[model samples]
Target: MKINEFIQKYRTVTKLVPGLTSSHTPHVICNDGFEMSVQAGQSLYSEPRDVADSYEEAEVGFPSAEESLLTPYAEDEENLCG
Candidate 1:
């Protein structure tokens, strides 16, 4: 799924299970109550070798090193007005 679509879906699912926070990177609350992060290009059967898939696709449209890091600068601030 696209990044925007993934964010929307994740927002809805997280409500049922609290302690879930997904900002720039997608994450989910695991069955054991721990958190799991979903990297780009990940599917239901994601593997360690899948890292490059998203990077390749993204390059065709907007080639940049930005996507290499998930969280943007603004999102790094823990306090809004600090």
Candidate 2:
């Protein structure tokens, strides 16, 4: 789907980065959950289409479950020393 169409469908923020050879593909950041990068060769005026397995991917690599569970407690201990 096109960039604008994707924006309309998802109603998210889209960013376009200009590259030396060509403008980079548009990427959308969703308000509710995740970020999506529009497929290459797609244009803003093309037909609206859903990206395959689009919602399954995550842009940022988050900490593992164990790390995440302990991070807050570790921070709290450091804060208490101040």
Instruction: Please name the candidate that would achieve the greatest lDDT relative to the true structure.
Output: 2
lDDT of 1 by residue, 1-82 (tens): 5543544465332222354322334464434554434444323222322333233222111212233243342343343222
| Residue 47 CA displacement from its true place in model 1, Å | 9.6
Cα-based TM-score, every candidate: 0.22, 0.23
Candidate 2: tens digits of C-alpha lDDT, residues 1-82: 5444663465433344542122234455545444434432234322323222233222222222223433453435443222
Error of 2 at 74 (Å): 41
Off by over 4 Å in 2: 1-21, 39-82
Which numbered prediction scores highest in TM-score against the true structure? 2
True-structure lDDT of candidate 2: 0.36
